[model samples]
Target: MSWYVYILKCSDNTYYTGVTKDLKRRVDEHNGDDKKAAKYTKSRRPVRLFWSEPHESRSSACQREAAIKRMKRTEKVALASRV
Candidate 1:
């Protein structure tokens, strides 16, 4: 199965990083249009996908997402720019 590291830019201008096996469905959930929506994201309303990276394993995807989360806002912006 394909795992992915995804980033969402919340309506509040905050970014959320997560790992998921289904990128499209995950994004949809974050959008608060479904029952599976994350509580934190549901209140944030509209969220735009800022970046994504595919990984071969869930562990790798989670690690990558965590690494990205540790980055400074500028670095995150740069990373998003590169993507």
Candidate 2:
């Protein structure tokens, strides 16, 4: 199994970054009724997957996610558009 760092483009135009093992299911949870869904995206609802990168381990995926989360919105947009 592989770990992945993912970026979501929220309905209100904000970006959310996180790590996940299963991209499809995780994306569904973000838009699902489950309370465990990402808090930042729950209200923003209807988040679309903007980017993703696979990593060999959970640690690396998490590190990348954190780095992406720290980026400014313009930087994030640039990153997403580049790939």
Off by over 4 Å in 2: none
Name the candidate that leads on TM-score: 2
For candidate 2, the TM-score is: 0.94
Q: Which stretches of candidate 1 lie over 4 Å from their true place?
A: none
> Which candidate number would show the highest lDDT if scored against the true structure?
2
Error of 1 at 67 (Å): 0.9
TM-score of each: 0.89, 0.94
| Reference-based TM-score, model 1 | 0.89
**Residue 80 CA displacement from its true place in model 1, Å:** 0.9
C-alpha-based local distance difference test score of model 2: 0.90
Query: In model 2, what lDDT does residue 58 have?
Result: 98
Model 2 per-residue lDDT tens digits across residues 1-83: 99999999899988889999999999999999667698889899899899999999999988898898889989988987888
